[model samples]
Each structure stands twice: as structure tokens, then as C-alpha cells.
Target: MRDLLKISARYGLIGSALIIIMFLVFYFSDENPLQELQMFDLFIIPIFVFFGVKEFRDRYNGELLKYWEGMTTGTIIALLIAGITALFLYLFVGWIDTSLLPEHIEILLGNLEETRDKIVEEMGADSYIESYEKVKGTTLRDIVIDSFAKKIIIGFLITSVVAVVLKRKELKPKS
Candidate 1:
């Protein structure tokens, strides 16, 4: 477990660093937030999860990996990345850019009508209104929760698939 954790943490740091750099660059450059986070969740993190698990199997696990082992390692990596990300987010919001939280919240509030319009078609007018009200009142805490939760969830989901794909059966010695 210790070795796995060390490997996972190293990979998690690489992934998180990539994400932080990309996020800061795009944010400071005024690129679209929607595109930036989405791309990171979809593309960047999974790539590292793949590498992390592959390395664990090849370098540490005798070139064999169980699905659960891969999944657990990847999940640990994700959890580490999420914790780091949350800390960074708190620092960025609390110290680096005091306006980040408010700006994101404001953007969300601004999209309320658009979101309602889309949800109303699928769920119903009542649901949309309820959701709109809930979203309209979203606080900084809510954003922080969502920011970390989304990545953690995405990481788990990605790892689930990646682990399966990378899992290798251990070869037994010949009698």
C-alpha cells in the first residue's frame, strides 16, 4: 500500500500540475471556463491515470495487475489530486484571485434562464423552476464542493475504464 501510494501520489502530482498550469493559463488569459475545465476532465486526467496504473503494473506489480488494484490505485491518485486541487482552489480564490469565486457564481447565475429553458424541456416547468431557484442561491461553498466533487468523480470514472483496459493477469511459474 505504501509503495502504491507513493507511485500514485507522484502521478497525481504530475496530473494536478498539468491541470493547475492549464487552468491558470487559460483563466488569466480570459479563455472560456466551460471549455477549460471540461477539457481537463475529459482529456488530461485520464491520460495520467493510464500512465500511473500502467507504471504500477509494469514496474512494481510483476507486470500483472488486478482490476481492483488498478482501480484502487487510480482512485487514490484521484483523491490526492482532488485534495491538492481543492487546496489550490481555496488559495486561488482566497488569496490569488478574490474575484474568481464570485465571477464563476455570477456566470452561473447569468446562465440560469438558459439552463432552465433546457431543463424545462426535459424535466418539466416545475423542476426547472425549482432547480433555477436552487442554483440561483448557490454559494461559494457550493462552487468549491462542485469543483472538487466533479474532478474526483470524473477521476474515478476514468480510472474504472482505464484499469479494466490495463489490467494484466499474473503468470504462474511452470511446475
Candidate 2:
């Protein structure tokens, strides 16, 4: 268990570094921030899964029990990584550029509302707009945390089965 925790911590650290690099790239680039964020999200899923499987393989000798262990391991790593990133962001962006968050959050909410309205309008469910309006109380930071939680949960659940299947080891009979 100590070995597993050490390996998991390594995975978390490496993943956090990669995320910081990506964010730095986004900061320097002139491209649309939303597009850059989407791109980051697209690549991060596979990265997380890869580290998850790697950690399981390293610690358990390619064997897992019932697959759920892999998922649980993956989720743990994801949460740790997300927590670190959130802390960094809060310290740097929240504290350093306090005004930036509110401005960007308002823009994001407007974009969300517009997209939601369009979807409801097309689907002929105008009633949902009232519910969507209720979203005004939420902030971008809240959304980020919620998204991280959901992604970690679902990603771990799905990847756990894949890891177990890919890395399971068979027990040998005693002589």
C-alpha cells in the first residue's frame, strides 16, 4: 500500500506538471481561450488514462482485482491532480488578477445561456430557459470544480475495467 501511494503521488505530480505546461502555453498564445481550453480537455483524458494504467501496472505487477481497483486508483490520481491545479489557479489567477475571473465568468455565463437557449429553442422546450436562468448563481470556479469531479469519477469508472482487462495477472498454483 505504501508503494502504491508513492507511485500514485508520482503520477499526480507528473500530471500536474503537464497541466501547468499546457496552461502556460495557453497563456502565451493568441488563440481563443475557450478553444485552447477545449483542446486541453481533449488531450487530458487520454493522459489521465495512460498514467492510471501505468500506475496500476507498476504497482500490481499487471494484475488487478475485479477492475474496480484500477478505476479507484485512477480517480484518486485525478482528484489529487485537480486539487493541485485548483489551488495553483486560485492563488495565481484569483489572487493576482482578482478582476479577471469575474469578467471571464460573466462572458462564459452569457455564452452558456446563449447555447442553452439555442438548444431549447430548437428542441421546442422553452420551459427549460427558466431553469437555465437559475444557473446565474453559479460561478466559473464552481463549474471548474464540478467538472473536475464528474470527469474524474466517470473517467476512473470506465478506465478501471480497461486496466483490469489489459493488465490482469493469473495466480499460480502452490506445489
Candidate 3:
């Protein structure tokens, strides 16, 4: 367990740093950081999870891995990355740039308008109205929660597959 956590924390911090750097790059480049976070998760989450579990199995666990160990390692790394990224976003939007939230809301509104007809047809006018209102009312807490939720969920799914693939039992010796 100690080895698991130690390895997980190491990989988690590394992953978090990379994600923060990516966020800063997007912010400085005038791209949407929120969108970038979502896009990057599709790639980064799987990679860190894989490497973290592999490291534990190879370096710490004598080339043996349990399904749960892999899952836990991947999950911890994902959680750490998500948590640190969310905190950075919160501080940035809350303190540094107060306009980011409004800008995001505006972008969401614009997208809703663009898809208004399709949304109404597929869901309903009420649904569109509700969504519009939700976007307008979105808070920093909401954004952070949403982002964290997405990351953790994606992480768990990737971890599940990784754990299955990486799990190894010790071979029994002849009696």
C-alpha cells in the first residue's frame, strides 16, 4: 500500500504539472482553457494511468500486479491531476481574471443559439430554456465541479481497462 501511494503520488504530481502547463499555454494563446482541459483529458488521463500502473507493477511490485492495485493507482493519479487543475482554474478565474467566467458563459450561450433548433427538436423548448438559464447561472463552483467530475469519470473508465490488462498473478511453483 505504501508503495502504491508513493508511486501514485509521484506520477500524479508529474501529470498535474503537465496539465497545468498545458492550461497556461492555452490561456496565453487566447484559446479556451476549459475546452482544452476537456480535450486533453482524452489523451493525458489514459497515458498517465498506464504509466503509473506499469511503474508500480514493474518497479515496486516485483513485476506482479493485482487488478485493484492498477485501478487504485490510476484513479489516484487522475484525481490528483483533476484536483490540482481545478484549483488552479478556480484561483485564476476567481482572483486573476474575473471576466473568464462571463466569457465562458457567453461562448456557451452562443453555442446554444447555434444549436437552438436542433436542441428544441430533439428535446424541447423548455429544455433549451433550462439549459440557457443553467449556463447563465453557472458559478465558479459549478465549473470546477463539472470539470472534476468529468476527469474522475474518464479516469475510472480508463483505469478499469488498464487494470484488466495489467493484472498479473504470481505463478505457483510445483508442489
Task: Tell me model 2's lDDT, rounded to 2 decimals.
Answer: 0.61
C-alpha-based local distance difference test score of model 3: 0.90
Candidate 2 residue pairs that clash: none
lDDT values for all models = 0.79, 0.61, 0.90
Model 1 per-residue lDDT tens digits across residues 51-162: 8999998998888889988998899888877878777776776777677666766676677776777788889999977876786776656666777898898899999998
Q: What is the TM-score of each candidate against the true structure?
A: 0.84, 0.70, 0.95
Give the total clashing residue pairs for model 1: 0
lDDT, candidate 2, 1-175, per-residue tens: 5545666677767776777677667666743332355445446755766666665666564445445556556666676676776676666565664554555556756776778757677665655565456455655576567646655664565466556665665677999
Best-to-worst ranking by TM-score: 3, 1, 2
TM-score attained by model 3 = 0.95
Q: How many Å off is the CA of 26 in candidate 1?
A: 1.7
Question: Which numbered prediction scores highest in lDDT against the true structure?
Answer: 3
Q: Which ten residues in a row have the lowest lDDT in candidate 2?
A: 30-39
Estimate the lDDT of model 1: 0.79
Which candidate, 1 or 2, would have the higher lDDT against the true structure? 1
**Per-residue lDDT of 80-135 in model 3, one digit per residue for the tens?**
98898889888988999888888888999999999999999999999999999999
Cα RMSD for predicted model 3: 1.2
